[model samples]
Target: MELLAGARIALTPRPVERRHAALEVAMLGHCPGRVRLERLLQLPAALADMRAVGYGQAVDAFSSGAASELYNLPIPLQSSAEFHDIFPDALTATTEYVSLLAGNKAWLGLAVDDFFANGGEKLWVVRIPESAGQAGFLPADATQLHDITTLQGLACVLVIPALGVVGFPDLERLQIPPRLPDIPRVRLENFEPQFLPCTQNTEDDHRERRYSSELSDMPPPWQLPQVLRGMLQYVSSHRPDLQCLFTLPLAYSGELDSPVLDPTALSALSGYQQLPDRAQALRHVQFLFPYLRGPRFALHTPVGLIAGQQAAVARRDGPWRSMAAKPLNTDALPYPRLSIAQTLGLRDKPGISVLNYRNSFSGGAQLSLDDERLVVPALPVADYPVDRQRYDGFCSAEVMRFLGFLRRQLQALGEQLIFNLDYRDPRPRLLLEQFFRRLYSQGALRGASAEQAFSIRESTPQEGAMLYEIMLAPAFPIDRLFLTFANLNGEWRSEVVDG
Candidate 1:
């Protein structure tokens, strides 16, 4: 993970020994601090609630090396949702933040609520593992019909009629008949779940904007546009091989406050055609499109809830235009590796773009029917935030790390060679050339011949130093779309162009 430092050309080899691989990530959320000294002691209890709820694995990513550490901010706040307000300066100063970036063994996930309250802010994410959050209950028997209040603050759940429990949130809209038939149903509510006392108060305390349940203090909304820019800037500069993913809670206000009803959302859902400037959340997401440019992070949220909401709308107002299955910038947000390589006259390089992720089911809730019993499986508590695309990005980074190791090794080996102008002696230039040529022969370069893939030569010694110059045209993966049409018998036939 260490970069080549200083101008010295010789390479230093540190013996490779087995050690914990760095997955250094930090999770920042809110906890009552100095001003709320009374509440400080409750922090452990609150974290205990997080672990009990299913965020144990995610929190373990940071705490596994050491017990999960909690550093209090001097400033006191109502909730971590405002964590976005004290970002950058306040964020970077914390012990947890410092440790994450300073090559420590552990990583963290801090929940500063509603991060990205301001724009043009930046943040770095090391590696926060995903979690399958806490659960709510729904009983199997008809006698427990009136027990909905037991699971009050839950937003959604799986109705394991034979095994588990079911939860609440105005189930009147579901219309269970007088007899309450045992039929399977998938219900996603408009209410945001308020489970963590650290992030938000109980439902009885307030119905204020809420999103996903947090096992620890971390932002519910993933990739806050402004925040994503900051994370991208940090990661691209510090660790291009690593990537980040965001998870947004499915929260709803009044009918008008819902994302499904929002006109700009409607526009985006249609064809990504036009969006109003007023849609701040969607706009924040929109900003990362063809412009932000690299693939270091992916945004993961409960888009299925939004889609379901749209379906509800269709049942009521009739379908307008079909809704978009994903974001308009879905294709554009990934790094355009093929085009860039082509522009640079290099072969296409695959796996250079950021990943795109959509929840198969918002909250990862699914329903299945068993003979006589309507079985709703246990909600995927730890896996809801899981994303494999981000893993692919990590794999790509590991490759880069290996490449860096090889580069350093080559430099070191070359330092052992004699640099001379003698005709019979192989100069440093020849050694470097051999290295790159080997790379090409190993399928690292794109071309039918080494001559097409790269050019390396010994430039005239610069005043007093010898220099070897290399121009490499890396192979790129094909990623362009083209159509060809031919006129035959006064009819036009269209065909896709193959690479």
Candidate 2:
């Protein structure tokens, strides 16, 4: 009876839980604010009921001239189909009359609609002022730079750790004012036109009948570059996890003429010779070019579409996947229809992503991203040795995004364990190992094995601080492929050749 002792057994450890990363975008622009009570009272009963009783705070917080606010897409407002139903009068309100008007000419509404249509899920909106005096495109002085409305919106983003992308759909509008035609007066059938005569007026009577026009000063050529440089510096210094998306201002000779792709204009916008730390600052920004023409709107910027595509890819695949060569989801066409040579010219240039049509395998022409390139300094820093700097990883958008994701995950881990775990604890090292192993298994790291994919080591500790150095081989997308076709021994043969 003593021989029948119970056996002891050990159970298997549970798998480590992975965090779900849902990419979110922050959009700052001039959007319609809360409809006034009087305006609401005048709406149709069905449309009026769309605004729920409990959402007053959110509505007021996002009202015209209000600070930045967060909103979950296709909710509260239900869906894109109900945008007008939820806020009925935003479409018709003009800049001069309404407190907050929908920026139709500026393309704010169109950008929002396009974002959701292209698979964006979460959004943070900042409703800035409409007039030039209240909110200039770029702040005039150092004091005003910190107080810029866009910077205020970015401040809101900093509080939310999950927001990864920031864009200003109306940012280009500040520099390029819309050119409107002059209004003509109609002649009366039976009565002579009467005009008021005053000592102040020196023009003819008919001329006095014309309405006063709004004048917009032409912004300086350096205005946009300076603004972009400031934004990039801010993002690089404060939040390395976030990416700023911008559309290069369209180049045109006259207000009435269509936009053209001017090399000199692009050079002015991207040239960073004046900055001491151009490489560091440029890595945080991605510039898109050549405005698009869609069925819903005549003309629109590419930033909204790029942001949506980035989110969609991050959700479906990993953030490390390249967005290049992906077909655009909207029914838009690249305006000014670039030729093959023109497309190649844009592709050769760095720091810009161009939209162009590519022939698919099925022999159909489909619009797709030619390449996804990050903005990087054309020249190496003078202070550093040429061999010491690695620009290849920074040049690839996918690689930079992967690095950002890695930084965010590591920061979160450190924050969670800072108080409880000791610096020398073996558990922390084991957790990091497990995390990298998971990433490697998911095909995010490029290597034959986990050891080759990544390495983590605790560096020499200083007073009250522990530092860890991590080196990872991030996965990269194929940028080029070569094929050769030849006839050998009266038989045609084709094979892929590596470069």
- Residue by residue across 323-360, what tens digits does model 2's lDDT show? 78877677778865667776666655555777886678
Candidates in order have lDDT scores of: 0.27, 0.58
lDDT of 2: 0.58
Q: Against the hidden reference, what TM-scores do the models get? A: 0.29, 0.71
Model 2 alpha-carbon miss at residue 147, Å: 12
* Model 2: CA > 4 A from native: 1-21, 33-92, 95-104, 132-151, 177-222, 253-258, 262-264, 273-276, 358-365, 377-394, 491-493, 497-499
Look at candidate 1 and tell me the lDDT of residue 322: 19
Which 10-residue window in model 2 sums to the lowest lDDT?
69-78
**Which stretches in model 1 have alpha-carbon errors above 4 Å?**
1-225, 232-427, 460-464, 480-498
The CA lDDT at 241 in model 2 is 77
Where is the poorest 10-residue window by lDDT in model 1?
Answer: 369-378
Q: In candidate 1, what are the lDDT values of residues 91-155, reduced to their tens digit?
A: 23322211100111111212221111211011211111112111111112231212322211111
RMSD after Cα superposition, model 2: 14.9
TM-score top scorer: 2
